[model samples]
Target: MTTAYLYVLHGRRGKIPESNLELLAGFIADEGQLGRIAFLEGDEQTLEDGIRDLQGRPGVDHLAIVPVLLYSATHIRWDIPERSAKVLDPSITVTVTEPLAGTAAVERYLERTLGAAVTAFPGRRVLLIAHGTPHFPEPFEELKELASRVGRTIGVEVVPTNHVGHPTIEETLADEHGPFIVERLFLTDGRLAAKMKARVQAIESGDVFLPTLEDDPVIINAIRERLAEAGV
Candidate 1:
């Protein structure tokens, strides 16, 4: 059976974010697989639209959907599957790969990004930020665990917080009076990320802000690993 890879993510209805997805699709396509991009939210190409487009292609019998998400939360575990199932043809098999929650590539990226901050500040705790969900706490919990693991390796305390949920970035950094590092787990440099960046800026000064993940190789490799896990 012929399989096509679909890179899906939360859309922000902007050209740059869409371009980021296009770039990711290009990288995956270089691996000799047919690929497409879709959005789960916003006004861009929808997941249903992408499925239809792929189904229209000749000899495309199966779809390997790799959600470009940071964690295996509601969108990965429920939304994608439900949305894809509704539009998929019975003859076409579909596999929704796991999100990039605990991937080694991500861990490496975090370590490399935070290494400098730890060196500069010595014993200061690092603030790890993620675009968290208010409906479910799994994403926040998962990020916390990931932070804990990375903290152990780097010899520093990695404090994880949701920019939108409980233990928010605002509250976490409220009582802080020293230099700190803020590492974001956001995938693209979109509107949401911009809002979080502004929040960080307003909260403190001299707190180092690590770069956001924008078409980073770690993300590309994580997506590749997800496709591999699904046997695509």
Candidate 2:
């Protein structure tokens, strides 16, 4: 019997969103021969504990760590592997796949999310608000490129804005028209999510539409496809 373990890696937040985790579990059950489903938190000790638990499971043949992250940052590339090695047996075949970045599915998801806002208004400005990384600028740039592509494809004016790093909401909202839509590009509803909604609401001139993470089917499908590709 082939026993495959689907391990989802959490980020600095120390916990994965229940919705995202549910989506991942559903994908694994639909695709691979799942032996055991395990959730690993984002701490050093918790990750080790999760790996050890998996290693101790009987009849386990293959172990795969799928990170539910947006980019291939230091944590996904280095920290996850280093921590997993401490508990994994050397004989076991282990594979760590890339995070959800540069995938056509993800691009499609972003396009659809922004496309909806564009369709609402014929010639108005639409902004794709994303959680930006200060140290690494690749994700922000990638989002910007995606927004530009979507705008050109749909023949609408759209701009990608970041909240944490440069080109902030203030900068993006400057010189913009009334009735703006701030689409939150996130996988979970955490502190950042709340803060984003509040900031948009505080804008006096325009109306903001807050779409929940569950509303975007494209994102859900993209995550499913990413897991399927990893042989989950």
Candidate 3:
């Protein structure tokens, strides 16, 4: 049976930034493999439709779905599996890989990103902003540990905050004095990055906002590793 790969995302406003996902898909297709993008929310194409379309392809039977998410939130914990189960054909073999949050590649990416921020603005506290889930605390806690680990590795202090839960970005910024380096932990550059940038700008604390992790080679390598693990 012919195998195809699908990268699932929580697209913003029916759109996503031009990032490594596009590049990976193109490269996969060039290598004679199938790669497709699917979204769980927004007005963009849905995951179910994407699966159906891929299954309809001639001789395609195995589908490897990689959730292009940084954290194991509700999307990866429940939504994707539940939705994919509903739409996949009986004869199709499907495998869903783990999210990118806890992966070594991601940790390296965070460490590298935070390292650069610390170098650029020495003595400034680093604030890591993540889009957390309100229903569960595990994801946010994971982020906290992640930040702490990265901080220890880089010999800097990294404060973790969420846009959805306690110690919100606004509250953290308001509580802290002096300039800070704000790093948004998003999978791609989209509305969330824009919104966070705007928020930091409005604070006027001279907080330096790091650029979004778009087309980062580290991230692309992380995805490649996931695909390899899944035997894609």
Candidate closest to the true structure, highest TM-score: 1
How displaced is residue 98 in candidate 2, in Å? 2.1
Q: Per-residue lDDT for 1-232 in model 3, tens only?
A: 6888788877766565456666667656766777688888866668898899998898998999988888887999899989899999999999898877777888898888889888877898888888887888888889989989999998988888887777677787787655778888876777778887777677756788777666666666777777778777
TM-score of each: 0.91, 0.78, 0.88
Q: Write the per-residue lDDT of candidate 2 for residues 20-83, one digit (tens) a residue.
A: 5565556567765453344455454366665676667777656776665666656676678776
Count of steric clashes across candidates, in order: 0, 0, 0
**Candidate 3, which ten residues in sequence have the lowest lDDT sum?**
12-21
lDDT of 1 by residue, 154-220 (tens): 9888888787878887888786544677787888776777788788788777777777888678888
Local distance difference test scores for all models = 0.80, 0.64, 0.80
What is the TM-score ranking, best to worst?
1, 3, 2
Model 3 scores a TM of 0.88
The collision pairs in model 1 are: none
> Relative to the unseen true structure, what is the C-alpha lDDT of residue 192 in candidate 1, on a scale of 0 to 100?
74
Model 2 backbone overlap count: 0
Quickly count the clashes in candidate 3. Answer: 0
> All candidates: CA RMSD in angstroms?
2.0, 3.5, 2.3
